[model samples]
Target: MYLGRKAIPLISALALSASAFAAQAETDLKFALDWRYEGPAAGFLLAEDMGFFAEEGLNVTIDTGTGSVNTIPRVASGLYDMGFGDMNSLIKFLDADPAQPVTGVAMVYDKPTFAIVGRKSLGITEDPKSVEGKTLGAPPPDGAFAQWPIFQEVAGIDTSTVTVESIGFPVREPMLANGDVDGVFGFAFSVILNLKAQGTPEEDIVNILMADHGLELYGNAILANETFAAENPEAVTGFLRAVIKGFAAAIEDPAAGAAAVVARDATLDPAVEEERLQMAIDMNINTPWAQENGMGGIDAARLDASFEALKAPMGLTGAVGPADVFDSSFLPAAEERMLP
Candidate 1:
């Protein structure tokens, strides 16, 4: 009886210790986003506000980023544990330095938003061949600009004929609006909306989505530091789960998504951001493939073909395979990732 009584107390003490440990064991994760707190970024914030990350035992901090290309280096340098970045940019970074400790853990945009937007009033035509004499404004760090070589190859545009003008992201739309440049390259939703904000009429702006042209590139993805991913695999999986939940929530209620963004930065115009979020959902995030395969998943054969197409344009030194860039082991089941 004395032995039994002693064992019971020990067991009770062990349970208490386990509970205490679990309470203190939340994994702190710092996430870097590709741009400002725009409408598209609402999913991550919504996931945090909705307690999705918390449910996974993760304490996540989301920070706005400068650009997609910059996120690759930021994650590789361990400045952030995970980030929202472009898949094409990630591939280029890996080709440059295969030794970098970063890989995409989940697919975000099923349809890449990369596009060549121009003012039709300036005589820019939707036909890729029409870019011959026009000056195209492109930012060095823009994902669409980074994919130009592939666009040039697919669209059959002669780089020699096109006047390529280097520009900054902040003033890209302004330049196009004022006729300073004939065309600009960026995400279609971003460029289109910004141009409208600058008083450019919706009909005058021409949006040419790259996916519709010839480039079969995947868009932004959730990237994780390889070392951190290897060390805390469950945390990586948990993070993906949270992100999937966030995307699902955003898909269900765009207003809620914009609210999540406003919750982070009150200075933003909620109406505009709400429309932006909806456009991102309609144009980039939600696609036929996403509807069929569910979110956070990729078609392996398509991904392989995409890498092959990017090789010549990107001028990859050594061979960097698609497997090296994307690791899908962390994604949740398709049913769990499906949009509502």
Candidate 2:
């Protein structure tokens, strides 16, 4: 059965039609990240670039977000199908309005990154109490600053003499570096590395991680609109499956992950981004608990304790519970989510 010229063109047409139909069959998902296309976002970006999402029958469109807390309303308002956001903020959001259609589906940062980054030259140190009587810069919408009340209460830091200046995000690090402020509230990875980039000596920097102190709150997570999730449960599961692969790839080769990020934004320094990526992996992503229990799920007992801790500072109405904010049904098997 030798193919003739006429049959060749007809076969090509059929192949093209089949390709178009397959593309149309995929589910379109809009995902919003908590921040810019930085080193931390490598997993998501790499998943898209490596065709992991496509393999999962998903057409994912990821956009950089303004703030972690701000991502809550974006998903709840049906503006996006899913988002990466702070879990503590999500808990507060759900507590305020139990009717919101968004909740966290997968835990990304098992240990919160919230921290008070200070400079030793400016009279700050590793002790949580060292912040007493010092000027601290806090961005109005920062996720870390939102947890200050909790940190203060848990760490028993005397804030009576501490000065908090409401500053913008762009100036938070600059003020700290210039000695205008003693410390700034931000993610440990972001602030510590940014300070180094600004020529601040690494030896002079001190990071007071809230998690290392007494804050039991979880960090950023993958949030899904409940309506979208119920409508497309398979898509949600598939998305998580792909995301697990992405994270595993990132853990295995951080340089490749950094390259994925640099591919998106050419203005970013590759070496700096690589270091940032490694820090996130070491400090946030691949924690001992995550390594032991696998990723993308939470410990119920810890989450309950976190809810209790947040009750006073966040002024909870006792409306939302651990079950209300996190739904782990969409995650892959425990073995599948294991780190490399």
Candidate 3:
């Protein structure tokens, strides 16, 4: 008697388990992106465009969030199963509600891309406190900027003289270029490139790399609530494995990945996508760390530094610890299936 297709394949299951085979049987996942379908988030676009999630039996819908910080509460409230967010904001959400725990599974950018840009002619230097006398543009006067006082104190800049302007994400560069504000807090990789693209003179800006000034934090992480991760560790691990694989592929060929991003969102301009994708590659996806440890590993000490930076800002200086912030189990499991 001839064995059926299923039985025939089973006979050739060299070192593979039935459970492992079943694991790929059409699992649905809800993933939230750090931003809309654009430049900083190009790795995720490549992941979705290249069918990485589909291969893992995941039906993932990439949603564009209005703000970088909103992705956190969305996960805690069960609005999403997983979200892409920064380390600083993620810690705040997790600390506030231990009842609904969330964990960081992967790191998208090995270093912080966050920074502030000022008018170059001022000769005020890249000091954080120097902006105290000038109008400063950042996320908001509330969220992270309020904590700028702490950062300013640490950096030895006098923020007391700084006038804070709460600019949404879009206005940061334009506001500075048009002389609407003296400086703006933004991602140096994106905002600075954009200003140049839009004909903003190179001489008009002096950038203070936030990371260099000691306000370091990781960006674009994969996070899920503890309940879901606990209930389905394998699924979470598999999804992250696919995410890392997709990012690796994207880094190897950003042009192809950028094209993939364009194919997914036809409304997007190719020139914009290409520029954005290249920026993502340089800043996040293909960093030096990814070359060594793969795309998703975390340095615990750096992570701790981020938590420490945010604690005083969020008014949780003594309320939280690193133990409550990150969970590495999912990332390690994902790393196992990858090529070293």
Q: Highest lDDT among the candidates is held by which one? A: 2
The lowest-lDDT stretch of 10 consecutive residues in candidate 1 is 311-320
Local accuracy of candidate 1 as per-residue lDDT tens digits, 217-324 = 899999999999998899999988888889889889989998888888898778888898888898888888888888898999989888888877888765578889
Question: Candidate 1, clashing residue pairs?
Answer: none
* Quality of model 3 by C-alpha lDDT: 0.69
lDDT of each: 0.89, 0.92, 0.69
Expressed as tens digits, the lDDT of each residue in 1-340 for candidate 2 is 9788889999999999999999898999999998888899989988998899999999999999888888999999989999999999999999999999998999989998999999999899899999999999998778899899899999999999899999988888888889999999998988998899888999999999999998988999999999999999999999998988898898898899999999989999988888998888998999999999888999999999989999998899999899999999999899988987
Badly placed stretches (over 4 Å) of model 2 are: 1-17
TM-score of candidate 2 relative to the true fold: 0.95
The full ranking of all candidates by lDDT, starting with the best, is 2, 1, 3
Q: Tell me which of candidates 2 and 3 scores higher on lDDT.
A: 2
Best by TM-score: 2
Better of 1 and 2 by TM-score: 2
Summed backbone clashes in each candidate are 0, 0, 3
